[model samples]
Target: MQLLRSIGFFHGNILLFCVTTGAGIFVSPKGVLKYSSLNIAVSLSIWAACAVLTIISALSLAELGTTFPRSGAPYYFLKRSLGSSVAFLSLWIKFFIYPLGIATQSLIISTYIIQPFYTRCPAPELPKKCLALAILWSLGLLNTRGVLTVAWFQTISVLMKITILCFISLTGIVLLGTGKKENVAKFENSFDAELPGASQIAEALLQGLFAYSGTSILINIAGEIKNPGENIPKALITVLPMVAVVYILVNISYLAVLTPQEIISADAVAVTWMDKVRLPFIFGSIAISLFLILTPMIHSPKVEYIYGFIFIFSGLLGYRLHVHLNQRSVCFDKITCYLQLLFNVSPPEDQDEGISTGKKHLEEIFL
Candidate 1:
């Protein structure tokens, strides 16, 4: 019952969106360049492949989720299928690797906020580490509340981030169509300098995998699902494509606006690309990025608390409902027994136990 409460109604789509879109675009460009010389075509191909692998992994996870459909979730599946040591290692890696990535991304996002104001501020500014710690703690507080609100918040943040990207893409398109010297051809020779070699392809693939790492979060909450078999699969099948498209378009927009060298020269993607945009895009990007930075912080603690609270509330709610239902059942049984008595008919055997119990409880209350 507790597990049901914790996992209930959190379908695969919701989880897929949360995990897939979490920190990918914010961090992937750096990862992509470190592996490749930031070749646009190669980067796109690697990212596309990563999305494919994610979908494949998600399908496999769906099978596991449906078969087990319990609270232990992925841990249970891995433990049963692969053995405990492997399962523990996977779980441990998931806890640190992903969350650390998320924490880092938040700091990256927050850096944009601070960077713009660094010189203007009175005493220079606080250290980057301090800002990162603040964001993490703030997010932890928000996530401690529970899952339902966190789900809704994530959906909204993704929309805002996607909308901003769309705006940038559209602006670039308009700039090109109007013959405004959009410089799309500047990077024509981006590959001429040094294209990625075979080893880099493998490395790019790994980085892309890291970018697309959170695809299985829904499976983590499978036990709480109302109908695990149906809902979990439906959500995953529908959500992954949307995430993949957004990721591709956003990265392309980055490349479109600035050449490979331009993207690679800067240390931070948001700061570099944002500075190039018109005021609307610059301020809008800042505003939108700020919102996204807060999104994870807000949702993280809420999700944690939600599942935590469910552990407490499920048993209590179930017990209360059970008692209430049993009481009502007895009342109905007594009324049926009276009708039988009046009609000179024999009442069901079960009526005796129910009526007697209800009578005893009612008498005790009255006394």
Candidate 2:
């Protein structure tokens, strides 16, 4: 069946926002600070620079997406611009990378969630993995329903996450305004201690880039978008800068409450920020709620990994079954045909026709 085209401009924007801003924002600041050697100014500057680079990348990709919007976007673009072989390899690599990336992010979320609850001992890894798996499967099942359901979930969750970040930022402002001046002076003195070298800056910029990694996801689902050409570009331009601003403000908020060193040492920066600001009881509850809301949205893209494996395995099994059946004598040709039809061992004629049409359109636009 053809995919439904129900995602509009607003929904598209929220999907991009949620994907881009996700768990990275809550966790990356600590790595940024560590990479920058606890220099708040340097880390924030890296974040700003990466944001600009991400926007530039999004704009270029947006133009490409508008011109030739399709599912399997990266593979489609590669196949058209380069060749089929390159595209095939890209698809294979993506299949491997998707699961690994999802598992890592899910584990990070679980770790952060349990960190605050740990009193003496550290958070256990077995529970973390179980929690991560639970999140992955839950979201995967949710996505199987329809893209519209996923869009609504993304919209609400992203807004809640943004609100939580804003609340944390405001709390930072309050703390900075009322807290003693000595702490600020001490932080300033440390900021000016020694500038990081080029290598260190580059490493820190990588962390910032990781936080901004999901901007291109809009292109991946372009086939389902209501107005692929108009909505794709609009969402990229509108949501990216907002994501950047939120990232910067969140970092600034972290600095507002704790010194650069404290942020660098923080295991979970957002949780630490709440704890240090002395709002653990109030903001802590809100932050936990935000994370729970954030989980499904962040885990949505990862659902593609599960589907990817299913498609790959099914195709392989069908091909092997077909080959086995083909080896039989000519008298069995009728039976082989029946089995092929029953098991769907070959691609449907209409699907090939649709793919040809899509390729022709892409060629007309690009060639």
Reference-based lDDT, each prediction: 0.70, 0.80
Per-residue lDDT tens digits of candidate 1, residues 123-238? 22356668778878877887787766666766677677667657766665654555544556644555565588888888888877876777677667776677888887888778
- List of clashing residue pairs for candidate 2: none
Candidate of highest TM-score: 2
Identify the candidate with maximal lDDT.
Answer: 2
Off by over 4 Å in 1: 5-15, 118-126, 179-182, 187-193, 279-367
lDDT of 2 by residue, 48-164 (tens): 999999999999988777877776677788898999999999889988988887887888889888888873456888988999999899889989988899989998988788888
TM-score of 1: 0.67
